[model samples]
Target: MDTTPIAAGTGHAEAAAGGGVRVGALVPLSRPGWVEAGRQLLAGLELGVGDVNRGGGISGRPLELVVRDTAADPAKAAAAVEELAGTGVAAVVGEYHSVVARAAAAQADALGVPFLCSSAVLDALTDEPTEWVARIAPAQSRGWRIFADFLLGAGHRRIAVAAEPSVYWAAGARILREHLAPRGGTLVELDARALGPAALCDELVAQRATALLLLVGTPEPAVPIVTSVRHDPRLADVLIGAPAGQPEFAEWASLLGGDGAAIPFLRYLPEHLSPLGARVEAALRERLDEAASFVAFEGYDTIAVLAEALRAHHGTRTKAADFWPHVTAEGTRGTISFSRQPALTAWQWTWPPIQVADRDPANPTRFRVLHTG
Candidate 1:
């Protein structure tokens, strides 16, 4: 499979002719479902490349991005990995969907190429025993805990969890149940795929649920759920939330229109930006002509971490195992240090900062920071 090269106005031909270090980006740029997300992720990665190139790059060699459109498909993602492996990129990064990340991880392992997952949150993406895969995003378990804590702190005792049957959503739901049941809080579980949005709203109201924790994995299902709940007068006051899911993206708000107001979701970055975060945000705003989302932050940080690792190894250690230590060290977003005692994953970013933000009705494009947990 052939992949496109986004040179960021740099010398694509010169870079490909042994003038730069190549890094592969696997994002769903062509698929109708994930096009916007792919675009934002690509923008963040390009910004990272631009910054590195401006700083004389790794060991004075420029960083070139070889872009591949995963199209949100697992098979296509794996194929892209195989193609990138053959192309001799120093590392690979960028995937929004968990399933695609899993596929890309497996292919990266088979091909012995290092893969830094930017935004995929499924635990299994790193759970499998693979030396080639590392993730910059916190796993679903950590995200669920943050969401549950936020709900409990907000006095949301009676909560409803609306989740689809996907592995990612199911894991989040299980974590929520385990965390909330012991705190003297009640949880009402609803199958999003089994029930219509209106029926789900009715169920939430009947159960006297004060908050609806939506674990729907994507924006398509979330739109209907958010709209149905908002339109129902009985459920108007119900606090709707998700565990680092659809609500973090601007497209989710756009799809729900005015109904997207006050929907909360967990984010890895804090409400108040760090000095580095503020700089990155400014760069993103200037380049993309829009506010950066959490996904973009993850994208930028992932590439930044990879660039740091490449520089630390002096561009000689390109193998996954060779760069694992440097990649897990401190980074721009936060310390990406991994722990094996708590989990088996080789490089899982433990204890990443998480915050809950809600979309503003007045400005659906911008989210209002609610609480940083």
Candidate 2:
């Protein structure tokens, strides 16, 4: 637990001999809406750091985390990163929303520190040239592709896409439509709303389409929409699915009862949550005491990958500029590689356990992968 700095890129033997280094964790903690998500992230990171330290710390130095709250606002997120700039953190991990991650990316780049985005879904994080920012979760673009492929294959020829105009939702819908075009399916609705649940529900119901691709972040926002979708006999045949952006589908299914059908894809159903998920399910559960929400595990895995990067180099010597190419690690989701096109790593990972659920009396609703094709 000594604060001695290990030589940058030193081996664990030497670094461990020296003790541990300090890391920074930036989460959105300033608001009630973002507090639990931030807490979940902190919980995962704590579990990860504890494991590393218990195993003799990273590069002989234990990993220390300095946490800050961004309040889920982009400007606040940037300010938080600015505060951590000169704090001498080996790396930065956090910012759950894509909006906040985008802000941290700008600051982390200027400071030349490795930034790990735990839950942000927008591909914008990896789309442009970024030296230090690497995302541990599947980009929203990939989520669109995976879900589109699953639906097209599952014989769903029609899809109704819906979301607010926010970057996260819009980006997801855009990518899904693009991926769906070649598959012989079509996005029948792209209802862009600027309102809350009830208003959004009215818009969604007006789509007049059957299969639904909900792009909202949480189930609460979609509860009214789901209620309308299931209760209205006009849309009775619709198959419901959502990206990992939202909370568990159980809320809607429980309300709709036997009216609901399976949800083929729910983004990141990490091993922690799904008994049939990624390879690291057991180990992750043992460490974090629960299966990670798609975003939480992404955050946990982000920390895990960065820890390896630090261990690989022996200590915190490599800055983001030099560390970009060296960031190669695997997690419960997939390989954490990077692509330099946007100046980020080539890592693009996904949660393959397509979470499918239904409300049949014979088969209670829950997530499971489906063969869309």
Candidate with the greatest TM-score versus the true structure: 1
- Per-residue C-alpha lDDT of model 2 across residues 112-227, encoded as one tens digit per residue: 77787777767777445766777666566655676677677678776776666677776677787788888787786555355544554455567655577776644445556666
Show where candidate 1 strays beyond 4 Å.
316-319, 327-332, 335-341, 361-366
The numbered model that scores best in lDDT is 1
CA lDDT scores, all candidates in order? 0.78, 0.62
For candidate 2, the TM-score is 0.78
Q: What is the C-alpha RMSD of each candidate to the true structure, in Å?
A: 2.5, 5.8
lDDT computed for candidate 2: 0.62
Tens digits of per-residue lDDT for model 1, 61-80 = 77888988888889988998
Instruction: Give the C-alpha lDDT of model 1.
Output: 0.78
